[model samples]
Target chain A: MTEDVPVKVNGLNHWFGKGEARKQALFDVNLKVAGGSLTVLVGPSGSGKTTLLTLAGCLRDVQHGSIRLLGQELNGAHSDLQRALRRRLGFIFQAHNLHGSLTALQNVLMGLQVHGRSDPVLQAKAARHILTLLGLGDRMDYLPDNLSGGQKQRVAVARALVGNPDIVFADEPTAALDRESGATVVQMLKRLGQVRGTTTVMVTHDNRILELADRIVTLEDGRIVNDTAP
Target chain B: MSLLLQALFGRLPIGWLQLTHNRTRFAAALAGVAFANVLVFVQLGIMNSMATATLKPYGFFQADIMISASDANSMTEGSNVARQWMYQAMADPDVVAGTGLFVATVTWQRTDKALGLTTYGIDPTQPIFLSPEMATRAATLQLPNSGILDRFTRGLPRDETAAIRPQSPLSFEANNITLTLYDTFAGGGGFGGDGFMMVSDQTFLQQFPARSSGAPDHILLQVAAGADPDVVAARLRDLVSDKSLRIRSYAQAAAEDLSYQQTKRPTGIIFGFGVVIGVLVGIVIVYQVLSTDVADHLSEYATFKAIGYGQGFFLSVVFEQALVLGMLGFVPGLAVASLLLWAMASATTLPLAMTAGMAVTVFIGTVVACSLSGAIATRRLVAADPADLF
Candidate 1:
């Protein structure tokens, strides 16, 4: 019932494939993420860091054990209920998954549209405001194909932030960005946490932004081996 | 209506945008759909024209009821019916007038083309066929070796058809006789014959010289204004009581002949096969286009699913694309079909015309075809799990 806890996991387990080919990806994972703070998950490849983040973000079904997201238990939850929770959270993928055909502004507007149908002018204003804040104001009309790699990732950040979601789950959001752009994205997330009480769970191995995190959870072999305040 | 407009052009234009984004792919899909539409339209058009064109000669027959040889299956296959059947049909109270006509096909040689021309021998004194040209030239056919040539002959030389006037000599090469053309009439040529000539009974006998004089090919009867032709025909059938006579109202007979041509003839079957092939081709082409589109956009759709957009939203987008293809594809199809039909009609003198009903039917048919393809292609999108984003 604690509203300050944005995400909590206990005995979390997940597997990939089926039959004899099946392999366990996560085993006995446990964690708690605080509200109004930036929590980064650090781990090597195939260590189940992305698996735990996606489970917390409702991107995949919780196969075993309990995951409480935004104060609602996700274990055995109805698909519709899970989808409802997903709308309150934002996701930024490792590849900066913006539609190639859509303009920068249109890509941001897609975030707002998924929430519900609203006045188009108001939606456009919101999308424009987020892009401006992310330093993409000048490239609002440029399609993803025309934008550089760093600019495209910034647009993805703008899209994830346009809806003002309660929580943001980012998977390697800065992988495609240069030092300045990567720092800009981390600073923006920190500002959102401080100003709007938004919670952020980012999965990244970049050490440059690790110093700014309020807390860091390190996963090794599907288990959280380290949890410490910076 | 305003809400629907917004759905189509505003909030829901994602389908349109996505389709239009790849210009080459969009153009290719439109071409595929249009080709299928054209195939169906032309096949149905020609089939419809065949049924209508063959009825052209019957349109000239003014009788409400007709008596033909009992075993006769179609207009061109008339056998001998004893002349006594006509007199017997005239005895019915509903019969106001009656006439007997003889039909035979013979070799016709004009300066331009040599082909078989069907000849109708009409009693000069009786009102046999209702034709504007015949009203003026009926009696002229009573002269020896005189007949009226049909003006609208199939594949006839345009110049010769125009130049042959009254008193023009037409050689009946089969009988070694040359018949003088009394005049030209409008109705007579179609599937029934390449061309036709109307002559008096005496002239017909002279031209053929082999046909029996005592029997006629068919008996035409005019019913009283208040009497139902079906009832009159039934009465005439009973009155004649001759096993060799088959009596029917004009409408019933024409319907029978049309049904036979559409279902039993090779031309009709070929056209039906063409329509089936058109639909099959549409399925294959549209399936390829939509399948490729879904495959290209699978990741985007997975993102949509991950972001809380339900399966219903993506499905609507796909169907919207289908509807656009259906409607836009029809434009080129209709344009091309109308041009082809005009050319066919001019070249063959067939009664082919595009009706508003035909356009609407083909458009609806195209929508159904494309929608079916879209439905099949959407399976890939539906199987896209948001888990792929991880």
Candidate 2:
């Protein structure tokens, strides 16, 4: 384990279901992601791209092997340890799951609350700053129901970044955005890596943004087929 | 205060936000809580009033101890006892004073309507009962066939003064004997009937016609100035040779009466039933509201978990919603129940009032009910796996 490696995996395997219906999703996966680097996991659907990402991101329990995230081993970790590790990480779901009841700024502020930030003024300023940078400055008060799909996705990005997480794990973050918004999001993630030493691990199918990734790892049939450096 | 506000209303006002996000759903949930409060409060109020009414007649007399015929289960069923027993009990030096009480039922007949009345025999000069309203007019009862009626009787007109003393010295027939109403007092009637008329023993015997003059129904005894009633009552039992009489302190008697009302009467059973139903209804409504809210926000909750929030955070938010519903729902329910209780008291002449104890009881009950509902509804949220959101 080196200080430059933010995420490291060895012989990780995961299975879904039980008894005779059990089927393996990822098999003996091994990888290492560098710190302050934009790493993208690219593969067709059901090819273990998501399983590996979720396992390394602490969203799923590591079933068969070791996952060391930010120097903490995640195999059979304590619940409190897992939760503490999760606090230093951020996630953006494919569906862009923003709370419908909250305004755009409120949704972003939720990210700060999970970290136990109680200052309303400071939270609002950080949330507003992120939303403004994401090109949602005018829509800060709008609810998810009232915002466009692109604007809603941008809000999710702002929420993921507002807490100043050490690592960001995104699943299809740019799927709902236009070309311009997509470029802007990728640029923001890249800039965060350069300026704040933040690491990003994303699962994507976008071809145009693949060029921006610091490293691209491709998988097939739950096996890593190619690991390329840009 | 500043810190408290920050704790409740800071960066994420999640509880208030979730509840008020949908106006229609929030209003419906509030209505459900208020409805439950009204049911519990009204039924409990009526039940309490009924129990109080059973012991009310006894409450008016200032006696340290009371003696009733062993066969007399309640004041409503007072039977004639040997007056010599009262004289025997008074032989103890702890006994300060004793008075014979006469209780009998009579048919009261006016112009076109007839009603039942409980006639009481009291020697007004002995100060056996407390009635300040009719105190100044006590002399009127010394006149033959004259008695003071209870103003709390149900059959009387709303404007009782107009019908009670209308010119010709208001006379009514009791058991076919003419009795004149000399004054009205503000004591409530017992469970046996809607009216009471207090007269002297001579007047009671005349009204009953068949009753003997020497046999009184009950005996009320006052203890010596510094003596304990329970001890004196116990001593009286040993002094009196009659093993068939029931002797107890006034407090003991009231407790016995209340216990009987609770165990043997339908009012108590019905009120208990109403309380069960109210709690059940509250649980269902709150569970439905919280369940649906959780279902709607399932993915969002998972997002919270994925972003590093623990189960405690989510539980706190849901419980906060429950607390809000409980408090907001209680306000309207208490107000409505208060108005309804007043109307019921006026209409039924029962001693119903919104007591402070009742308010606190119902408020605590509402919060507990809502909290239980919240706990039940959060099963799915707590069991949610953040991996499912993928």
Q: For residues A1-230, what per-residue lDDT tens digits would candidate 2 score against the true structure? A: 12489899999989999999999999889999998899999999999998888898888888898999999999999888999988898888888899998899989988898888566788889999999998889999999999999999999999988988889999999999999999999998998899888999999999877999999999998999999997
Q: Which fraction of the native contacts appears in each prediction? A: 0.54, 0.84
Model 2 bad stretches (over 4 Å): A1-3, B1-11, B71-73, B78-80, B129-137, B160-168, B189-191, B213-215
Which regions of candidate 1 are displaced past 4 Å? A1-3, A71-73, B1-9, B69-71, B78-92, B128-137, B167-174, B187-192, B213-215, B233-246
Please report the candidate that would top TM-score against the real structure: 2
Interface RMSD value for candidate 1, one decimal? 1.5
Give DockQ for candidates 1 onward, in order: 0.57, 0.76
lDDT of 2 at B165: 52
At residue B162, give the lDDT of candidate 2. 45
Candidate 1, residues B98-181: lDDT per residue as tens digits? 777788886776567776778888777664555555657777877778887887777666676777765465444547877777
After TM-score superposition, what is the CA distance of residue B108 in candidate 1 from its true location, in Å? 1.3
